[model samples]
Target: MVSNMAGGQPPWHGTEPDAPLGALEVYAEQAHGYLGASGDQLGKLAGLLRPPVLESWLRSLRGRVDPMDALDDRGLRGADLRRYLQAHPIAALMPLIDKLLVEDTAATGLMVVVADQFGRVLSVQGNDERVAAAAEVGLRAGDDLSERRIGTNAIGLVVRTGRAAWIHGPEHFLYRMRQITGAAAPVHDPDGRLVGVLMIAGGVRVARPEILALVKATATAAEMDLLLTAMRPGQRDAARRDAGRPQPAARLGLDVLGLGQPQLSIADRRIPLSQRQAEILLLLAEHPEGLGADHLALLLDDSDLDNGTIRAAMSRLRAVVGPAVFGSRPYRLHVPVATDVEALRAALDSGDVDSALRLHAGPVLPRSTAPGIIDIRDELRVRLRIAVLKSGDPGVLRRWTSGAEGRDDAAAWTAYRATADPETALYAQIEAKIRVLDRRMGADATRMQRFGA
Candidate 1:
């Protein structure tokens, strides 16, 4: 590995040809200049880079004269580079790329070029014969071969379309392109920005569908690495968006357990949910407490039924909700999946606030209007409303509790009326509220920072 440890090196300075061009690209050429070669080493480096006609040809291409015209210009400036290096550390991806090339020597026979989000070459890897051949046509590591320069190649087309693309055989726009087939796929950051492009090039004989699949796979692998490295747990999904895959909808605990009725959205999609199942889900979601059979039966207006009948309802409810909620416990439903209450409890118990915050997506149950579940729902409303007061910041809480003001106030007053001793359960409620408010405030700050507000 070339050592560009000093401050003035190019981004690719100390990196091996297979390594990514991360922060090192921003420094002046002198930084990387040292690693480029001196005396006999210069000849060896030149042989690998394949200078002369190749460099001259690249210099003539359109969009070939800017700072990014050369691969060395892809590194960000001081602050931007710091931000980038913090997340997109070259250390993680470079080793993997090197291993891929070394292990897949036969596959590496094809010209492989890696570029920054802006289409500037970051690195290139190829076997000797292919390197020489590509050099003849002005394609080498760190060269500006964007579509704007060479016109309609895989790299350029993928960049333009933000999708995987192939420019095979005669599809090349340039007159000198008859020698190869290339496939390029977009690589994205957690934000779905075009962070990089990965391309594979080979002669027509190797232009099979599998070859394109390999290229796309490489791009996807690269993106997953970037996302895992950069994102805090929640932001990882945003990175996957570049694949154009819809996220599986957020699984409310009941849905995960198949205990709720499915309602059709505006798309007229039917979601199947039984009335009893829906009632139970809404009730649990409304009241964090496990509802006793007697309580449930009363609220359900099924007083005429015997205890055995109520027990049957409770048994059915338990089966539908899945065993994960609570293990043979009576009357208390505890969805195994973390809710705000559980997350706060975890944070309090374990002192891992990030873990707690990550687990809590919203209030335990969100936005249901089941009339039969109203009594339990009111309890949940009061608990959460008190939680808001204690926490002091309602950030996303307001969104969660939106339009439930009447119910929430009613619940608060009802709770006050039920317990004559004002001090009862007061500490627990205060603690929950304090934690919730703090969380909301932090979330708000995060949203503001993301939007530059």
Candidate 2:
């Protein structure tokens, strides 16, 4: 609790159980009850809470976070937290934070929280009592406070929008958090990429307008310090090293599906790859155990392809992505790589045919006939086809029969004919298309028989 606010507490302020609730807190409580209430209840939130808070509340609801439930979600700990902190660029800025935010807040009994870009609490500092109170509710170092877990909060809001935010009193989504107030700001590096968030919090301080401003200013100073550190000749190497590695900020995804040239996505940037490079990446993604150059060469081609060619390709691929993502000896991805194929499979597994179909572009790589790629392409094609056939939904069937991959698939058309109303003109169209395909196949067979030398 904020035992002391420097100046006297406002008339509306209430920390004890006996004290009357602040007007804003009372309204905020009403807003919480309105969650899942009909129409204007959602609309009415705008009149009650700030736009940011309302938006965050809606987002938290969508993420399936229950407002009344408190989370003890402390996953980032032990060796993992240590490694993450060591690799994180913000670890070097700790001294500056201590001087600027931590030391000054010592008297206020306000806790200073530093969260990584993903909203995992890295450190929590304050008076011993305040620190102990924070830990009891799992707001300790290594605990996840991201929207994905604890939902609407100051640190999570900053993480989501890359902007400063403040949540006061009942503005917090979790019931246990209503007694606290927080203001958080995004802390970025020299390149303007968000590395983490800096936050300050205390007992339900309802009207501390200066908190947001102070956090933002501190964040700006931290960014400037990062710039200065990068500018220094002696510290430049460290900065460069951090730049080469993926920060807690960057979101990585590999786009290998569809007919468009395959691309590797690093945060917002997409780096297009050569067909061979894409093929190599796809194969590597499939085989997480790591493939030797010789084995990878074979998967890339049916016949003998030299290992030196694979090494050269790997080198080029490493340069395109960062060298940090790759590992030698057997050659594998060091980081978790999410792909479009995996997304499709996830949707299918969850019975979300609509999303799965929407996600399906063309084949995994329509033009690629590399031995391993062919197997993968056929497997995905079969999986999608089977899913479409099983789902007797006419909309799904029509969608399948309409796509370039599914157009030639007779089985899909047959399934469509079985499920769809035969009275429609679409049924006649399918009949004609199927006949044409059959005749074409027959003619190809005749040609093959004639050419049997």
Candidate 3:
């Protein structure tokens, strides 16, 4: 592919994993330097916004359009570009462009043009002495390359084909393109859709391997910038949209069964139950098959509460908690009732990330006066944490802890982990004790909100 350039073969059709186009070496070196100096700061920002916003910002500032027309095309302003680029400058690309021009005397007569997805040039760079004659045609960056302008050049053709193209000398399809060489490549979004093009247009003799390679490399880095930004909001919204399809109601007995902690209202009737009465109703609700004393004891967290005590609890609970406390048959919790676990899951599956996170007010289980329900609560909270992570909204965590008046070290550590930053892990280890304290406090908070404390 390298040797066939003069005879009209396309520069190697596409990139090889290890061997990037030659000019790419300079850009790659710059990328490494930038990453090292800032720990990939731009990459971090890219991870927080959408692709379109990041790419448009880069083209105007780093690409350096004369009047910032690309920014205009992208619905951005010159001032905004100035401030954003100041904050997130493309340090690597700028000097690399300078080096490419200075190294090749023949190429010094050339210029580089960077364009957006629509192919309007955002920047142009070339030595004044080398490009003296070519400047007459308004070929500087920020010009549109439609049929009315410098027609049929590499920039326009790449935009048209959505592929890399080389228009050397007279091969340019336009009558006005007699003096230069252009090697262009298309830039794509994270999804691999075309978003822009990068091209090096210069004197025909300098249309060498390095120039083509550099253009391709810059475009790739810029494309990476675009992709990382989309992960912030779009990724989560797309996921939610995909998961929002309706689901059939859960199986009756499998999902949940129990009288709520507060006696549930039924037909305006008020029923009061003794502790034993409520315990029996809860045990019956927990299992589809009526539970025997051994299994009931295990579920109730009262292995020592003898079957007789349970029998008495069941009787009193039935009288008030159910139809009648201890009325001949013991009270039973019903199948249709919603357990905390089931309620949380339903909210999440319905795409309510906020609601799901909110439901987890505390640790799953607290040290309980009633051990059986406490175990269930503990298990429920574990599930809620997982659901929050999968929900993909960092804000949800913030809202969940909004009411906390003090720092919750464990929660803070978890938030840091959710961000996947290295610093948070170290902090988490140093504050291990805080995890227990936070859990205790979170439990209290959740109980107050959910169970009226």
Top lDDT hit? 2
What TM-score, over all chains together, does every model reach?
A: 0.33, 0.52, 0.31
lDDT of 2 by residue, 313-345 (tens): 899887777777768889887765667776666
Local accuracy of candidate 1 as per-residue lDDT tens digits, 1-453: 344444232332221122232231222122223233346643332222212212322332322322222223322244332223222323246566556543474464776767655454555577778877775665655444556445556776666668776655433445456466676778876678886777777775335566667777777777788766555555456424422111232223233112233331211123444565555555554455566665656656634446687677666755544344443234554432222342243232322222333344443324444345554444444444444333322332333333335223322322333333446575456345444544655755534432424
Q: Taking the tens digit of each residue's C-alpha lDDT, what string does model 3 give over 371-411?
A: 77676665555555555545444455545444342134344
* Global lDDT scores for all candidate models: 0.46, 0.74, 0.46
Evaluated at residue 351, the lDDT of candidate 2 is 48
Ten contiguous residues with the weakest lDDT in model 2: 10-19
Q: Alpha carbon lDDT of residue 399, candidate 2?
A: 91
Better of 1 and 2 by TM-score: 2
Off by over 4 Å in 3: 1-261, 267-280, 324-335, 348-352, 361-371, 403-453
Superposed Cα deviation of residue 166, candidate 3 (Å): 51
Best by TM-score: 2
